[model samples]
Target: MEPVAGSLLAPLLLAGAAFSNHLTDSYGATANYWAIGLHISCWIAQFVGHGIFEGRAPALLDNLVQAFFLAPFFVWMEILFLFGYRPGLQSRIAKAVEKEVDKFHQSKLHGNGRATNGKIIRTIASLALSLAVYKYAHGDPDKQPLLTRWLHYYDSMQEDFKRKTYMNIKFVEEAGKDRHLFETAPFVGHMELKFPE
Candidate 1:
């Protein structure tokens, strides 16, 4: 009905990014809790805004999607950050989150093969949730304007994250460098280099 939810989402995401950065700076490899908190907060903010402020109810099904699937999108991002992607002011914050996740898995939280499986599961879950939200909630022509705008923002973010991730992995594969996989990663000019634990 209004741009309230969309507008609020931008700040929510920014806040999450800021918070993550702070946590990363302070705790380094032990920032999983911060990532989880950010996801949970985002979900609550969106849910409340859509249902209360927008007066849209947002459907129980939509609520479920937010709770069960969409909430973890951020968490998955954190896991990806652990892999060595550097943070960019011009890029999506998801890249940073993913690097954090990789750090968690590589360190004390070592999950062995199961942790890798968790990443796969989370990926599937996020895709399924995004599809569900897109197909069901974003279909109404009346909502197309808002939905399209939101998707545009989301896509830009997702793309930035994906691009950085691809480049980081490619660097590792080609140079056989493991620096991009560290938790206390160093910032080098415009690129990020992760250190080995």
Candidate 2:
């Protein structure tokens, strides 16, 4: 296929290169303008021809390599088949194309790849959920998996609050009012603010 495609395209490609080279030799830098115009026009013609003759968008829209490189081989093979090149191979190809088309149609009906993607996502999510449930049900209560740890976060927070409460001494506003208590306090000779009772 590569050799066939290369052989079919090389002449045209070389001719185009030669033409551009000739333009550059004759017209200097101005040749670039003409070459650009021709290049654009050729691509335009390619897409227009695909629309008119094939009645569908060009393969370039979906796959550039298929349109540019492989298309010539495919077209050549089809032409060969028309002239009885390989009947058996052609029949097999036809069957395969038919099967693929049917598969495509079925997938389209099932919402065109979304169903498959959704099924995968659902499977992953269900497995994660099931694993979480199993861990919460049977695993040692001391250590929890990262995924299932959030369920106990509030309880852990409450325990932390209890610990924090035990660690802190109560603050009494009147303790500062007694001069002896204030004198014996660690903050000696520090300026203190006293509010009226």
Candidate that scores best on TM-score:
2
Candidate lDDT scores, in order, read 0.57, 0.64
Error of 2 at 48 (Å): 7.4
Candidate 2 segments whose C-alpha is farther than 4 A from its true place: 1-58, 113-197
Best by lDDT: 2
* Deviating ranges (above 4 Å) for candidate 1: 1-111, 141-197
Q: After superposition, how far is residue 182 of candidate 1 from its true place, in Å?
A: 83
TM-scores of all predicted structures: 0.22, 0.34
Q: How much is the lDDT of residue 119 in candidate 1?
A: 47
How far out, in Å, is residue 70 in model 1?
Answer: 18
Candidate 1 residues 1-197, lDDT tens each?
Answer: 21543464567779989996687667753464455447557765765675456333333333667656565554544544566434452155556757865775465345365644554465446557855764685466665533345545776999999999999999879665454455356655586679988
